[model samples]
Each structure stands twice: as C-alpha cells, then as structure tokens.
Target: MICGVKQPILLVLVHSAPENFEKRKAIRETWGQDQEGVKLLFMLGIANESEVEKTLEEENVQYKDFVQGNFIDTYHNLTYKHVMVLKYAVYHCPEAKFLLKVDDDVFVNMPNLKIFMKLFMAQNSERKKILCSRMCGNPVLREGRWGVEISEYPESMYPNHCSGFAILYPHDTIFALYSEAQKTKYFWIDDVHVSGTLAKKLCVTHIGLEELILSDDEVVEIVDSSFINNTKPFLFGRMNLDVHQIRILWDFVSKYTPKKVILDYLNY
Candidate 1:
C-alpha cells in the first residue's frame, strides 16, 4: 500500500499505562526502524483525563491516543480492553498489511518478523488470508499461569486458539471478527472471544507455531537478559509476567548477546 514496498505495513497495537510507559518506550527504542514501507502505531490507553496532556508530554505519546473502555470497568486489567483494541485497529489503521495486536509488555523480533512476512507471502501470495498460531483444539488453562474458569466456555479447554499475548491477523479478517462479536454475546476472555470464536466465523486458521515467532520460554529469556545484564531483549511479554519476575529475568540474561543467548536457548 505504501509507495514502494510490496509488503504491507505492519500495524502494532500497543496498550500502555502510566507505570509501564517508560518500559514500552524503551522497547520501541530497541526495535525502531524507519524503513520506507513499515510503520508502528502505539494505541495507548490514558486512564486519567487530567493527566492526559501531561502523560502525552512525559511519555512523548502522540495525539492519536484513545481512552480505554470495556464491558467491565478495570476488566481483566488488560484483557478487558480487547474490544477497544479491535475497534481501533480495524476502524483506524485499515491500510496495514497485517495487524499485530500485542500487549505493552511484549517485545517483537522485527528481523524474524520480516522472515514471517516472506513465508506468508510465499504460501497464499494473496496477502488476504487470516493466519494465527494454530492450536490443536480448544485449549483451556487449568490452574496454570493464565488459568481461568468461565461458565460460557466451562469445558476448561479451547480448540486451536492463539495465545492472546501475540496474534497476527490480515486486514480483511478484522471485519469478519468484529461482525461476529456484535452478533454474539458470549465469553469475555479476549483470546477465546476473538482468536477462537470470532476467528472461526472469519474463517481464520492457525499458522504453525515456530520457535522464532511465538513461544513462552523465549519471552522469559529476553526479559531476563534485559535487566540482569542491562541488555534489551526481543519480544518480552510483560503482561503475563510479574514486575519482580521481570526484574529477575532481566538480571539473568542481560550479560549475553541476544544471538548467543537465543542460540544457546535453542541448543538446550
């Protein structure tokens, strides 16, 4: 869509608060690339109206910001803001080739991401199909890190659902998912609601999970390396991790280079 590059620009939807504002900004600094065709948009949430102006100035956030509102006030903390996220991505940045909806705490590996873009382009070549990290079936968390028991999906399992932390959807897929959400009033779990249910309606399929693209372990290692050794990491999922845990992980991995560290991680 841009003037030169064939690959569509990647739209990154970010959610940030006063506390993690600097952290997210730092994450962007590590991955900032002013390529001709690609652009990253940060859809931040401002909780306080009075502090909005000050927050923008302090955080260096632009005017293209939205106040987050959801079904439940303070809903699931970050999870509850999913609908607002969908609205912003679909309605606002329609020109993007792919929409990368990520939490403020997560870090993206941009170079590897370009590899993924090439792979997807090779497969469909249409650049229109929806692709998610394929799940075997409906999986549910049971007393695990993200375990939750909801009556709507009481089976305690999900069928081939992508993790909420990182999901990639084609531009057109947004319309299908949003339309289904309007018609169906079901569970509030954002991953299940969009990647599972709405995705089903949109005819979205899960892409194979690869080590580079999405993984829980890599998340920990990156965050760990960042703090312990004063090294910035690639794609650290901050939301799922506790602040103290983040500090600890960064402490452990920061001493090594990302390539050596991640390669070592793969070797083990």
Candidate 2:
C-alpha cells in the first residue's frame, strides 16, 4: 500500500455543465458505498461567477476546484483545458497520487482501476511517473471536421495511445506537463496540444495499455473479474458509448458485491 492503504488518491475531474452534473452524479451513485480510500475531487467547469454559485447550490457538492474561462472551441481545445486542469491539480492538490481526467459523460470502473494499480505498484513504483492508457495511435480521418493526417514519429515517440478523452497521470508527471506548457503557447486542442504534442515535446514517456477508460460510440461489456484479470488495463477513449454500452458494463459489474464506498470530504 502506498499510504497505509492500497487505494491511490483518486481525482475525478468533471466539468459541471448542464448534462455533466446528472451524469457525474450517476457515476458517483454507481460507486455507492464501495470505494474506500479514494479521494474524489469534483471539478466543476463554469463560464461566469453566477454559474459557480448556482452550481454549488444545485448540486450540493463541495468541489475541490472551480475552473473558469472558455479557452477552447473545437474538439482539440479540450487538450488545453485538460492540461491546465491537471496543472491546477499539480500545483494546488499535491496530495493526489493518481489523477484521472475523464469527461462528464464517461463512467469509470473504479474497482478495475484499483486492481490495475495494485499490479503496477507491485512491479515498479517508478511506473507512477508515466501516463498510462490504451494507446491509440493518431488516426487518419478524411471525412470529418475533426479528421487529421497522422504525423510520423519515431517508434520511441509513438509509445501507444493518443486518445485524450480519459487518461491517468501521476502527480509528478502532471507537474512536468504544466511546466512544459508554460514554455509554449496554449494550443486549442487539449489532447494533442497538451497530452500528446506538449508531452511529446517534453519527452515524457507514455505507457501503452489494453483497456481504455474512455469509449467510442461502440458498446463494451467489462466484467469485474475480467477487469482485475486484465493484463493490460486501459482507459477507454474515443468511442461515443451509447446507453446500450453503459448498461452492458454497469450490469456486468452489478453481478459482483460492491465494496463499501465512503466520502468524508469535510474530514478529508
């Protein structure tokens, strides 16, 4: 165990947009009373001062940080937002061990995460320095507004996945990412700009994973046992997971008895 317990510090950064609030609540409800030793930091995204207060009143959840300003527009702007948020965590929330950057619509399988980290820690504590996810090489798309020609990089540069939706970064590495960004202009697309482009420029190595915490539109069924058994646990990214997929994954996990999840934010 890293700190008298096996759980790593968990920070679920959710942009508390209209649709995001209910979605995030559902995710927390999924945890119910099962996740222990996980420190949750709900990140609410707001555009104005009033929205922040309104969010606080409506949700009734204490947030670790309230990120303001609209810095992005297109699909790529997310990268900059993510990088800046991570930077906030690094500079502000130093206690967090592992930072999980996820979208409002996404659902994370926490038990699987715990199991994966357990194995990772068992193998090498140094592994915490690198970002881990199922590596999606930059794709070449010709028909969409978001399509881009994949750039060629040395095998060393293309470590694994480039999907920026859901990624896990250790505390130290996140600091490095923010440091790198300060040296350059903020890019609009946060994934390539912050996670891939900026990180690549800094030479921070990324580890390839098998399962992705972020999903595409496709539906995937993940089992609790299978999740723990996964040799290569990945954070799903890129797919637009519909209701069907969510049900599949949720129902599957429901088969297992949930461990007691507690939230002592005030005491925390």
Candidate 3:
C-alpha cells in the first residue's frame, strides 16, 4: 500500500519510462498529490543504465510510490508492465474501490475524476465496469511504428478495446481481467492485448468514453471560455505537454466550478 493511504477510493497507476524523472516530478507536483480518497503510484521497468537506476532508487526512497518490474524498459514490453500492475494491485491494494491506469504523458483532472466517481457510485454502487476512450476496428499495421506480424494478430481489425493511455477499472473487473490475462497468449501491443483481446475473452463491461463525458471539442471550448465559469473536464489525453503546461492546466481546472450544463450532455 502507498504511504498515507489506508483504503483508497481510487488508485492511479501510471506507466512511466525509467528515465522520465522530470515527467514523474511534474505529475507529483501537479495532479498526483496524495488526496484523501486517492493514491498515486508510478510503474516502471528495470533501467539498463546504472545512473538511472541510482536516481530511481533515490526517488523511491523519497516518494515510496514506485512499483518496478523485472523486464527491460521498452515499448514492446508494455504488456509485461500491465501484468505487473494487475498483480501488484491484487496483492498490495486489494481494498481500493477503483484503479486508473494512465501513461506518463497524459494529464489527469483529479477533481473532475472524483466528481465523476461520486456520480458513478450514486448510480451503480457495484462498480463492475471499465471506462475509457473506446477504439473499434483499429487496423493492424504490418509496418511502421505500430507494426505487428500476422502471427501476432492475424485479424484485420482489432476487437473493441479502450485506449491504454487512460483507463479506469473497478477493482472486481481488474481482478477478473488479470486472471483471464494469465491464460491468454501474450501480445506486445498492450492496449489491444490487455484491454481489447483479453477483455473480450472475459466479457468485461466497457463503458465508452462518450458516455462518461462530452466530446473533447466541447471540453476544450469550456476550458477556453471564461476560466472562472468553466467546468472541469474528466480528463485530457494524447497531450505531449511539458511541466509548465501541466501546472497551468492543473491550476486552471482546479479553480473551475463544475456546472450541471456539462452533465446534461453526458450520455450516462
């Protein structure tokens, strides 16, 4: 269990590269602070360089919120990273009500997330679902950056899966998927393999991104409007933002009052 947190309502585990000290620092200083009902942890793989490992150890000594796996830190080993998270959660923080998986670069609106969870619990107390940006029929590229061999994924289109950048899962759902993942064949594409294929195999309920909140366009408009009058966004993704940008956005969103107008647009 992370320090200062007993039984967390939500545990956010961020997948980070071992050398991304700056990104981790930015997150802790910005949105990853230790809240009453929330706990924050960063997942990392072994670093090849001695200096990087030394630095990571030092950071862990100070923060004590890092979960490290044995595999080498590489894009292709993300599946291993995901599995490590599930195992860690099941063993270490089983009492947490929800688990949020996110990448290091994504910006999380923590206040909005807490509000969303409160609304969600009011409706469905069971909390047996996965919530994320849904992706359907994504093509399997044979070459380039996201290349995959035919043997890896023979199907032309991927199964319905949530984007791995940011995903929220109930604790029960996480346990179910984690058990299923052990039986499924390992695939290097973390999002497709874990959230898409394995989730399909287990028949986990996936709540689409649109249902949780309005589209990103409306969110941006709201954020760009009168800062004092704007409503908070549930989350913002695919943002390659720097520390300065994160701090600015965090401060801006923290002050915004959530309005019922935005809630009216939500599908569920």
Candidate 4:
C-alpha cells in the first residue's frame, strides 16, 4: 500500500506495552486502519513474563502488525524501542516518506494528520525535519525518578529535541539516527536520548507542531466542545485517551469527517 498511488505519506510506529492486548485490538479497529497513504506498525519489546509473551503472541496472531525488538519491554528501556524504530525504518520501510512515532495512549485524527502533512510539506522543503512539540534546554536530573547517573549524561542541560509522545520524522533522518544510536552511549530517557542527543549529533531540524497537538486538558475541552457543538475539533492529535474515549471520539469524528477525508484525498 505504501509506494502505490499516494507515494506513502506516513508510517505510524506506535509504542505499546507487552500486555496491552485489548488496547492494541481496539486501536486496530479504530484509528489504526492502514488506508490511504498511512500504514500502522506497532513497536514492541520482549516481555519479561512468559504469560505476557503468550498474550502478545495471541494478539499478534490477530493483527500481525508488529516490529518487535529483543530488549526488555520496560519504562527504562524505551530508548531500546526508540532505536528499534530507527533500525526498522532505515532498513525495512526506507521508502516511506515520514515516520510518526506516537505513544499508544495518544489519539490521532487521520484526516487532520493528512492535512497537517500537506501543510507541513507545503511550507517546508522535503528534508530531514521533525514536526512536533519541540523541547529545549531541559535540565538533566540527578536524584529524581527520571534521574540520570553522572555516567549516563554528564551534561547539565538537554539539547533541543522533539517531544517523543508524538513525533513526525522525515525519512532522511532514520538511517542517520539509527547509526547515531548505535555509537552514542545509551540514555534511558528515550526522548532526550534518541530525539535530542542523537538528533542533535546529526543536525536534524524540527518544526513546531504544538498548535496541532492537544494537551490533556485540551483533550477534555475538545471532547466537551464536540459534544456541545455537534462537531469535532480540527486538530492533528490528542494525548492520553483510553480505548473507550478513543472509540467515542472516533464515533463522533468519523461521522463528521468521512466526507472531508474523501474530499482531501481527491485534492491530494
């Protein structure tokens, strides 16, 4: 479906935990459909427990859209999953125009994502760029939950980077980042490490997508407004939505936007 009619606009690599089987199925049924220029691939790592592995195998049998890595699936190992995306994208789906790395909890509007890409590509030349809420000058913690040992990163502050919750990576950066991640010392914070440290090492530019992405509060606000106004918000994405919330949001948004996506598809 990628290199066919639409030139493969987006490949979404979703970060998912090993045991979240139902959530994956729900997503596949909802917004994760592989249609148009969008293809969905789930990024998973090895589960610690055999039960979890069994569950994952069962789930994989159902949808079979996984690009799993050998690293253990844990919070501290998110960078492993992050690098897995770069490796897979580099060697496997290199022809895809863009890679959308998103958390499983986030809600993405397919039509709005299409529109966002059209707008992003129109205003900017097709180069190694990221589109997301960019982070800059983040302090390196030493004693907190997300603390990094002096050995991990001796720097006082982090470099400019795109937020990992929902990042859009131009195709050119995939091999560069994969190569960088292999040489760079591993950092547990995937966003700062892969998106910031490795990204800066290769001179990747980022375009701010803050306006298109919604916050947790904004998610509630948008859902409420959609209920009140009988129409959905025209934003690119939402964060921390559960399966039920996503289902409801899709029910409302799908009703309102089928004609719009059809129109946009024709226009593109």
The candidate scoring highest on lDDT is: 3
lDDT of each: 0.55, 0.52, 0.79, 0.76
Best by TM-score: 3
- lDDT by residue (1-268, candidate 1, tens digit) is 4422455567666655645665555555554334544556554444445565466655554533334453323335454466666676667666676777776565555654555555555556444344544455656775665667665467755755666767777777776677677787666567777787777666676654334342465555545444333233233333455445444444443344444232222110
Please list the Cα RMSD from the true structure of every candidate, rounded to 1 decimal place.
6.5, 8.3, 2.7, 4.3
In model 4, pairs of residues that clash are none
Clashes of 1: 22
Q: Point out where model 4 deviates above 4 Å.
A: 1-6, 224-236, 257-268
Q: Please provide TM-scores, in order, for all candidate models, with all chains considered together.
A: 0.65, 0.66, 0.89, 0.87
In angstroms, give how far residue 190 of model 1 lies from its true place.
Answer: 0.7
* TM value for model 1: 0.65
lDDT tens readout by residue for model 3, 169-249: 887888888898888999998988888988898777677765444344544554455335544345553455567656766
Q: Backbone clashes in each candidate structure, one number apiece?
A: 22, 29, 0, 0
- Full-model lDDT, candidate 3: 0.79
Error of 1 at 240 (Å): 5.8
Model 3 is weakest, by summed lDDT over 10 consecutive residues, at 259-268
